[model samples]
Target chain A: MTGAGNSALLSIRHLRKEYRPGQPVLKDISLDIDARGLTAIIGPSGTGKSTLIRCINRLVDPTAGEMLFEGRDLAKLAGAELRAARRRIGMVFQEYNLVERLSVIENVLTGRLGYVPAWRAFLRKFPAADVARAFDLIDAVGLDESFATRRADKLSGGQRQRVGIARALMQAPALILADEPTSSLDPKTSVEIMELMAKMGAERGVPIIVNIHNVELARRYASRIIGMTGGEVVYDGPPEGLADAHLKHIYGGEEFL
Target chain B: MNAAAREWTRFTPGERIARAMLYIVTAIAVVWSIRTIDIIPEFLYDAPEQTADLFRRMWPFDWAFYPKAVHSALIETFHIATLGTILAIVLALPLSFLAARNFTSNPILNLIAQFIFVSSRSVNSLIWALLFVAIFGPGALSGVLSIAFRSIGFVGKLFGEALEEAQQGPIEALTAAGAPRSMLLVKGYWPQVEPAFWSVALLRWDINIRESAVLGLVGAGGIGVALDAALNNLYWDQVGLILAVIFCVVVVTEIVTSTIRSRII
Candidate 1:
């Protein structure tokens, strides 16, 4: 089936995830993500925002429901089909999970692992085109040529996240999901990272669904805002439509706001 | 009541009693061992004289005998250690992946791998040498197999632990990238665990060197065969030279491995 709305790129329907048998992390959640622009999911910790994003990629399998993208059910796929589907959807982690001992260029090139043969990957003999694309994406993410050879552990948090974004974009994805990509960063770095992600997503014409706890960043960067509380969506609309009442409801208090 | 004057002790009364019992048991064990050994006063009194005589005989180094006996035997010991370590690494590498709970996740496979490691470790290399000598009919091949079989457990166990300790974040990133199991291993797991893998291999090789030097006692070829021949013929000087050679080799290997380990990581 196509997306719930024909214009949507990913349609998640009645999705539910329970890490435990009876304790659901994500309640029956249904949302349609459009083909372009950034959609930010704003929620407090423990509200299943991370789980929801992960479920779309099947990193955390949903207990029930359908994730329809590119005319296939992501939740129903297995083996090779699942991997093929996953390669089209890029992911960025909260921790900027670059392999610590590897060089920056190598970490970024890992995005093409799904398409590269095992022997080629092992030999670090990625195809010339993929290598060129990886370098372009790295430059696009604001890392200079000098940083490419440096080991990942030597970089600052912002630099590492830049590499993380570059790696995600190297997948040539139709959709990118960033799970709290700036949680560990300073406010300035967080804003820069958000800006970078938005720029990369827009430049590539890829729809981005980001789970961010920063309400201000969400308001500033997102075209659409999805407010979640207690594993359920409290609001789904354009950024300007998200009012203080909605924030109070989503976070369960006006104390922090 | 002011917290009952803060009554506190490092050990409870029961623990104190247990500690006392442990000390008493240790004392009894020492006394029992001394009684069992049954050292004669006559021999004890003459021990120093015998040692002095032995050393006197061992002096001058047996320099002429080095080429005829010690040289070839020393070479054989080195070969056995190197070959055995290489063989163990090959055999243990795959088993380590199976044993690591994070890597395999199959409890049955993990259990099988653990069983093999435990079995290999439980049999001492000397005992393994004896067994292999019977099967392979006594040669450097038997010595090599003995060291390898005994070492598999050690190398596998440490490497498996290293694999298990790999950070989950990098693994998650690769899995999200849709890398297959093999790609994940080559790019994801291998990069993270490379230093540990090399560390374990080098450590095992160092241990194998010391162990192989003794394997020839059971007729598996190594310097111990030369030592045995010297001892049987009562060539104390020759025996002394063999012992010195072994000591020097062990010291050199220790130095080499330590230098390599420091540089690698």
Candidate 2:
């Protein structure tokens, strides 16, 4: 059913995921993502925050539900259709996940793998335009041209995360999913990373969905916040509306607060 | 303060008895093995004298024979090793992917690939040479085939292990980016395993050189053919010369391959 004024880029209805047969990680989750704002999914460890983000990208397949993006159900897509859909959704991992032996530029170039021919990607012969765009994106991510030729393993954690961000943006994706994008970084670097993500999301008009454990950082950067506990959403509202009572309910203890 | 702090070093009676029994059992096994193998003290005492007489005959090695016979046989040995290593690596590359757990999750394919590796590895190179010699009627072709077949298992097993141990993070990232299977292999997996692949190939080549040198004893071709002839004709000096050549070749191959491996890896 085509809609007149629906701005939702992604619509999830009754999404569920279970790694084990009887125990579910995500239980009947539903949400709608607009086209241009940062949404943070905040929760304690062992919750389904990461699972919900991964389900959108199909990195972790759903047990049951509908994930509608670009007018197609992501959960039902398979093979070539799944791949074609995946290319439009960029994912940033907790570990940054840059190929360690590859140079920074090569890692970023991998983002264009879906668009480039397989043989060309194998030989690492990216088109001139893609190379130019990669350099531009690297610069946008606050990394210089010299860092582009350096191998990924040689870079520090923060620098590698910057490369991760550049690589994700190079896909020119419609949506970006970051699973604990700043969890491994120090507090200062975490703030910088969150700011960079927020600015990039605004500039590119792409919705950013991040699964984070840091509540303060989430409140500081997230335009909209989704609080979850025990594999179900406990609260969903703007960051300003997240009260201490909601935090106590979501985290299940007052001492940490 | 607490009952004079019981001593930790003292062993219980049962532990002490078990330790004594372990030593007694080891000693008995060693003596039994010596008797079973018939390692006579008399033969051991006579070995030095016999070795001295053999060395006296082998002195003044046939330096004049190096140009015509020894040189060509040595060249043939090198050729056989090179060809065999190349063939083995070409065959092992695809088989390694099939054997890797991450690549081939299908249990039947993994078992089949693992079986090929086990079968090839279980047969010694000399036995492979003997079988090939019978089939091909004694030539360098037999030596080459034998080396290749024997090496396939070793290369495949090591390379497959390297693939399995590669970091999963990059593979997941590539998959999420919608990269196909080939792209995931080349861009995601190949870079991580490149050093291991090179190291294994060089190590296998070094081993093949030594194996090929001895293949000619079975009439499969190489310097071993010269050695076999010298032994049959009772040419002690020529036998010494052939051995010296083999020694030099092996030492040089070891040095060269190690240098390359260190530089690359």
Candidate 3:
């Protein structure tokens, strides 16, 4: 995950996604993200920030666009190639979407599922190195090592999100896409999660793209900012360049800011 | 709604007469059937005394007969329940898969699977035992087969609903990550369904115990055979002993199943 290419780790050109046949949700959005840094996409709900990041991993298919990752076009690939691409890209979710009944360690190991064969994972027979890596990540994420044996259902919202981040890191991904990862947490936990993501991204030199709703929080943690509105990019530059007028344009109201 | 429509609440003269006529017709039909069948209301009042006298004659559950009743007959009851449940599980798991709308939403397959389930469950267990006994010999095999057939329908319908309703969040995540179909079942589906599987299987175990106890009455090998023989020979004491043993078995099964259920949830 370190220093694959210091140049823009992920590049996009003319990305478009339409859930319905004629009505487009994301209209020809394009942006580039550098490695080893935090880039935040901020906007109101349903403005397609989530859709734009999901489109990078092909969780939602882009209707039309070219997404280039390390000189490879993501839109043109299919089947195994797409899966291989996903293995290199990790995702953190808003709901802290750990498998509730699975042990915390089991949930983290799911990040390694792309690399491990089906039968091996089924039998819970992961390699010693992978198992040790999962333990290391759990510890690094500030979770008690004993928590690995407990089911994910028993954890509080903040603790569960920590496990979610640990799972994403277990993949050793070159890029991380977080879809409102801190929205479900309390204010303090949200800031802590933001700090954790920034720290993890810096340590591993992985390009991290997060969709956030809190503009101030984004400014605090992100080196770069990409604001979206009405399925298109409204602003893209350094965090300092994201002014009050730009926020008004992206959210359609200046009073809140 | 409208003022005029709201004002018109009462029935007219002709409508009232028509309703009275329908009631009179229904009364006449009921009276005729009662007469045809020679209805007797006295049975409800008179039978209680006679039933009490009969019970008094068979007092104390014939405690002396309990020892003989505890041996091979009890063993046979366990066998009937075990074999029946195994057979039911074999047929039920696959049928449950087909019946799950999520797995097999095809109209033809869904209809056929449900039809098989409904047809198997339409008759009572005793009726099934009777039919199987008439077809096969009067033995434990017939009783076991009958109980299994009834259980297949019950477990299949319940477990199918459980499978269909699995938390779709995990499955969607797995598919988004390009997991194969089998991996989706193991990772996304099985975790949600495990508790449900336990509850259903444990419930079926208790039901099979009750069924197996009575299955012997059709000449299937269990304690019910002893009860049937005692009743035929007018040995009320022996019949009382068999009933007592059956009660003990029911209570033990209740305790066991409840314990298992508590652990699962």
Better of 1 and 2 by DockQ: 1
Q: Which ten contiguous residues of candidate 1 chain A have the minimum total lDDT?
A: A1-10
> What TM-score, computed on C-alpha atoms, does each candidate reach?
0.97, 0.95, 0.85
Give the candidate number with the greatest TM-score: 1
Task: Output the chain A TM-score of model 1.
Answer: 0.98
Model 1, residue pairs in steric clash: none
Off by over 4 Å in 2: A1-5, B1-28
What is candidate 2's lDDT per residue for B159-242, written digit by digit as tens? 999999999999999988988888999999999999999999999999998989899999999999999999999999999999
Q: Candidate 1 — which residues are off by over 4 angstroms?
A: A2-5
Candidate 2 achieves a global lDDT of 0.92
Q: Which candidate has the highest lDDT of all?
A: 1
Q: How far off is residue B252 in model 3, in Å?
A: 1.3
Every model's DockQ, to 2 decimals?
0.82, 0.81, 0.32
Chain A TM-score vs. truth, each candidate: 0.98, 0.97, 0.96
Which candidate model has the greater lDDT, 1 or 3? 1
